[model samples]
Target: MPFQAAPPPPAPPQAPPQAAPQGAPFPVPPPQWPGWAAQPPAPSRGAASPYPPPAWRPPRRKSGAGAVIGALMGVLALVFVLIVIVGALVGLSDHDETVSPIAIPTFSPFPSREATTDTRPTRNPTSEPTSRPTTRPTPVLNRTAKNNTLYRAGSLAKPNCRAGNASIYNHTQFKALILKTGTCMGKAWAPALERVGIDWSPPKYMIAARKGRGACGDYPSPGSNVPYYCPSNSTIYASTSAMAREYGPLGSWNGIIVSMMAHEYGHHIQSLSGISDSWWRQTLDSGSRSGKLALSRRHELQATCFGGMFMRSIAASYPIDTTRRNTLLWAYSHLGDPPGGPRDHGNTRSNAAWFRQGYTRPSAYQCNTWAVGSSSVS
Candidate 1:
């Protein structure tokens, strides 16, 4: 009686299983797949199932649309890459087109001397001298005169400047010979200059007996033995005695006289062409003594070239035989600047070479000293 425990209540009574409802579809059993547990017994109607239903699986989606979209995106990416590459190539081409190699500057101040083909109309030498157009074009002055239009003119006409038998020793005969030579020079050069639109007029001639002040300066400044042209007066001044002393044994030769006169006439040509004025301006503006001397050498050498051109033009009529040619070359060799002296004139080699160039080439363009390097003019 001291340790008695109370007893539990009795269990409720169980009801019988119900039958299937009318017109209800029967449930299909799951397939027996490998590695799965066996099917459990079906529960009574209206009763809960013993196991959870299998997990739900959605229907598979079509891959066609996704594949097509991905392919389009890939094509777009490829196009973008190509555009970038093409743009880069085009930019490089543009840069190459704009940039060029740097040109080296020359030391000479004049324009380039590269040979150019002359296409200007040439006058016929056989035509009458007065047949030129009544209207004449004005010559181009300024720095352009250094490389004037005269250079483009055709070869100088031969005036047939025949040398007379008169010896340079006779004053009257020498004067006649010089006058005749000058007349022939005018005939040859006047029409040539006119063709180039330069005014043509004969320079005054004077055979002086003594040194006196003239339009340019005193005649025969110290150590100068040749005839001088005074551009200011457009006259040539030469002394008979000076010529005799300068020429020595060659004084009797008419060829020597003609050459000397021709050289002076060359200066006259320069003056008429405005080259002398342009050259003088450059000389005055030169910064150093050496610079002035260099320009002077070029000027003198150019005159020598002109003299040679005239000589060649008249060679047939003047009958420049072997003896005369040799004498002229020898004279040129001695006409250059003396050693240890002011080098205003070119050296013997340069003077001779330029003269030979003019004789052989016979073109004013060939005598363009300003268009060459200093070494060439030197």
Candidate 2:
């Protein structure tokens, strides 16, 4: 009976073997983060794990006071950079822009006295351009010269000028002479302008030992060679000091003096007719020295023609005998361009020839210096 007990333990009923999971076995889900939902379960059994444990990683640490200090320093550095940029801008705003100074021409007087005898024309300066004419077309003033009737020779009728024979001696005498001559010029030219329907006015005459500065800009110091016509005020500025001292015995060369006066009057006429202003614009536009020189030559040559015409008109009244005529011609011809100087005035031959053209032809059309070749003006 005791041996039967051992068989009794084996006799405990055996349960049926457990079946494989139905459908498919699901994988355990990964742990959820504090604020996140649990992830979905992995795929069926026999498949590699769909959700594996996250990779090994070092734990995160909080920033310390040192890190905070470093961040503050970087912010300060950024502020410093902004301050420097603003300072540079403010500094620049405090200064004025630089400007270049304008150049002023100085006095280099021409030899004061006219030579008694006709001397050989002064040789061209070592740097003078050859006399060959430039074939290129020159820029025209007076609306291309064609449209402005004043530029045409004989556009002005003959000016029956009176003889101006003032015995210029002292400063007072010279002043009187110029005023008388200017008055006579006004009388003669006013009517001529009226005939052409061109406006006319009496030009102011200023005779001084020195012309410092005026509407025309600075005058060369006391001894400058040239007399200037200031269009700004319609004034003629002549150096009585120079003329009296150098060409003294002024009474002897009455025709020459009058002719010189007429030359400037020609410029005044151009101004009245709006030709000079155009010429000046063209000269400024020319830009280059040579281009300006060409334009200046044309301007002066035209004035020369005008002077000749005026001289011819007054010839009977003024009595320009052969010797006086030669003197006048020599005065013009001898005024050669200064060697190595600006060819603002034409060469001797061109100067005299243009003058002669105006004198002999007595027509505005004949004196169209603007239409001639550069060599003729040169």
Candidate 3:
């Protein structure tokens, strides 16, 4: 969660105690494992024999050493069966569940932070997108803004270096120009934002909320589960630290973090365009009698589209015919997809189309998704 509290780390699982020698019995209770339960009657009372379903029969034994080896094989088979049976349990099954997609989101959504299951946004990203450029800025963004400064300043053009807290993080490793808190919206992202024409420098005012607890305007309110951009405050707050602990050490946390930061920054882009404020007012004007508080699915999907823009911008650093296309495709697939909960979120296909819409076209005008009768994002 980008705006919620970090959770306590999980304790390591404890091993079951060793049993004492048989003569000096440990006097343990019968194994509660359901495998030990008497078998249920057949699905129908009229079935064949009184015996339970036939136990797995090990292969037939050969003469001497072969028989001994077969007996050992039989014991191993029993252990395997026990393992398979225990795995049928819900609690046991959950323990071994693997998140299918390789990407790890930097943080979970604010509302779904508590949902620890495989609740990643409904993404279907390509296996390998191109790499973003190294720290030095490159002038690859195609632009229409007559007065664009990105070409002039290069990497130093716009500055919102709030989340770059040098003391806490090693910026060089991430390849970002800034560190935590000194930069708020990922200055490593500056070039990408420039690619999308969202080059308005976020002011110090925006930094106040992303700083530490007392950072009051100097920093963001800490929490990862409830990431939001407070229009009144003009700040974006996220607490992905817990999530970092959850997925970072395992080695796939960056893609998730970048995607999420891109999403929040997407909201910032909306604010800059006056869309968020306009929509907020519109939602308020609709009144309680209105059937929904959903200002529109368009808004959320637009942000998803904007996020796609960032990824695309990053991907653009790679040449057109490179293998990175697949990586970008993979990332594009996930961002636009619905994480599968409420209809509030768009699904994978919608996400992919919108992301692709932003990527190939690369324009804010093309991303105006709220017009009547349009699924083409613009």
Candidate 4:
């Protein structure tokens, strides 16, 4: 049995070659290997692979710088928003703290009413031969010694200014008293001005809590004891309430009242003499802060001196004893320019001294405050 040749194992079976589909374009050869034998004809030259290329995946990209930059940008945006909100809150808080109210002082009389208007209707044209009227502007008296009529005014005779009244408390009574005193002042000044070749006219007097639409423009609030002389309207707006409130409590201060009224009257004298106009013109020409202050001091001090002259003229009739004189001097001191404020008016010493000059001498020559140097006025 072992020696038998095993009858040569049957020859391995071989499949015969088969023809490609009858319509094939190219001839086909017999298969070679098992699975890779026919790969659907080597993909015709550049044609895409039949089996999808391993699902495509891009090269891994490093995102380190981009990621960090993006995170930083987000943080900056948030900070900007916070800063805006904080700034707005701080502004509101500061505004709240800065708001408050102002209080008026009781002794703040003489608050200068620093104000006017015309309501004339338009005239209809008339068909008539209008004649040229011959009229001339009134001549202002400024051609006196030192170019000041007051300076040239010689010793003025004592006037009858014996005003009766200690202090009138009632508003109406106070007004009447002022009117009475004004009458006396007019009587004294009219003749004096006439003698100096200056035209004389009494200024309209008024007493009000507040005066508006005055000749000047707008009347300042009244009651701080300030009096105003409106050149445009030739009026004197006196605050009776302010004066009465300040002086009424103190017994009758006839000398003080008279001196105050005289001070205002002095302005009328200046206007008539053209002193005020000249002074104003000089002020405008100077056009400087110190220059303006100098001019204003001279103007105000001159008026104070003129007031003294009036007091002297009336001394015989209304005796201003030492006590009354002292009272008036004190008032003059208080009327001076505030410390560290615009020196429009002279200081306390200058004010009292100027008044005293006129009071003691009773002459316009002695009251030539404008002729003095800047230091004298200051």
Assess every candidate by TM-score.
0.61, 0.56, 0.40, 0.58
Where does model 4 exceed 4 Å of error? 1-146, 209-213, 217-223, 248-251
What are the clashing pairs of model 2?
Answer: 125-339, 125-340, 152-364, 153-363, 153-364, 153-365, 154-363, 154-364
Task: Give the runs in model 1 whose Cα sits over 4 Å from its true position.
Answer: 1-145
What would the per-residue lDDT of candidate 3 be over residues 1-378, giving only the tens digit for each residue? 011111101222233244434542222553454446677755777656667787898887579988799899999999998887656665543553233222233222222313334655533333222353446555343222212222232222233322222221332433242124225344544554555455565622222212344233323333233344555555665434333443344334254355455666767766654677666766667766332324445566667656655555554332223444455456545543234434444556666666666556555445555542433321
Rank order by lDDT, top first? 1, 4, 2, 3
Of 1 and 4, the candidate ranking higher by lDDT: 1
How well does candidate 2 score on lDDT at residue 62? 55
Q: How many pairs of residues in model 4 come into backbone collision?
A: 10
User: Candidate 3 — which residues are off by over 4 angstroms?
Assistant: 1-199, 203-226, 245-256, 287-296, 316-325, 331-340, 372-378
lDDT of 4 by residue, 158-193 (tens): 667666763455667677777776777777777767
Candidate 4's TM-score? 0.58
Model 1 lDDT per residue over 1-378, tens place: 011111100122232123224322211342343344777877778897678988999977869999899899999999999998777656644433111111112112221323112223433323333534566456664435456666666568898777779766566776777889989888877888877777789999887654556777766656776688888889998776677677757655677677778878988988888788888999899999999999898788888888888888888999887777777877777778888998987998788877777777777778777777787767
Which residue pairs collide, candidate 1?
Answer: none
Model 1 accuracy (lDDT, Cα): 0.70
Compared with the true structure, the alpha-carbon lDDT of candidate 2 equals: 0.63
lDDT (10s digit) by residue, model 2, range 37-67: 6678877788776689799999877579878
- The positional error of residue 122 in candidate 4, measured at the CA in angstroms, is 65
Candidate 3 differs from the real structure by a C-alpha RMSD in angstroms, to one decimal, of 30.8
